[model samples]
Target: MKKAVILLSGGLDSTTCMGIAQNEGYELYPISFDYKQRHRKELEAAKKIAEYYNVKEHRIISLDNVGGSALTDKNIDVPEYKGDGEIPVTYVPARNILFLSYALGYAEVIGAEAIFIGVSSVDYSGYPDCRPEFIEAFQKVVDVGTAAGVKGKSIKIIAPLINLSKAETIKLGTKYGVPYHLTTSCYNGKEKACGVCDSCVLRLKGFAEAGIEDPIEYEK
Candidate 1:
């Protein structure tokens, strides 16, 4: 069986990516991060998702000291649905870069062929790290920095939802039988999703556009 590392955030997209990776016949190694975000809900959700998939290895790394963005710093507020064009304060500084770096290291250590991240340029918060250009650049970094890459084996960074809108991603995930109810997409990190926040808004919007009601509970 082929091995693949997935950066699973226990959120909508990353959970969907898990389904995608499984569909591709890769042995799943899902990794989540605890960056001292506002709430532990996401990490909790990640744990549940990993359990549901029955993955062999589910590693949760701590980045509590690496605080800067609104998600990691309580001083910064997680803003509500602002227009989607501007980069929000919630953008964790170099988050994806750090995440992919971790995933790359794990992949190399485990001899995995690919690392999957659920980053979509379309229908995403305007985080610069979520863009296609950044993913492309990170792929280069993986190619050059890893010992495997230098030794003629290159680890692939796969973003299956890069070009898809949130709605499209939801549709694809549904086709793959992804258990969306186990996922959380709230930046507020509440027990029930704070539906007004950017993350929740986009997720709700995607479900609406897909003509399917979201299975998760939301704060009224």
Candidate 2:
């Protein structure tokens, strides 16, 4: 059986990726982060998703250092952008890099051949880590940073949604039986999704494009 580690963020995309991994018959080990982000409910949502799928294991790691970035800091506001070139205040510095490194480390420990991430380019333009080049660069880094790679074994970074639009991702998730209702994508740590945040906006747009009514309620 091919084992894999999925970086699940409890968002629409990552939850979809979990379904994708299960569909591909990979024994899944889902990993979530408790990186002091403003929206901590997503971590709880991630646990629910894992239980729904019966993932082999679920791990949560903390990214300490509440310095800079709107996510970790309580003062900085998470800007609701007008969908332009700005990266926004919600960009956590080196977050993806930290998460990927931990995923790689866990993958090496368990001899997992691949690590799956849910990053996409079509819907998320603000995050640089979601780009294909970033994944490619990280793949190279993983190759050099591990004993498995040193022994000529490949550690592939599997990003099944890198090229797909958020709408297409939703379609795929639906096909794969992903429980969209179990996911959370809000940047605010609230009972319902604060629909104004970039994450919420993109998620709502995706559901709209997919022609499926989102199951979760949003605070408009």
Per-residue lDDT tens digits for candidate 2, residues 46-130, read 9999999997789998878656887788899877746987787888888889999999999989989899999998888478888
- The residue-by-residue lDDT of candidate 1 on 1-220, one tens digit each, is 9999999999999999999999999999999998778888889999999999999989999875477778888998888988749888888889989899998999989999999999998888899999899999998888788899898899999999999999999999999999998998998877788898889999999999999889999995
Query: Which residue pairs of candidate 2 clash?
Result: none
Give the runs in model 2 whose Cα sits over 4 Å from its true position: none
Question: Where in model 1 is the C-alpha error above 4 Å?
Answer: none
| Candidate 2 TM-score, true structure as reference | 0.96
TM-score of each: 0.97, 0.96
lDDT of each: 0.91, 0.88
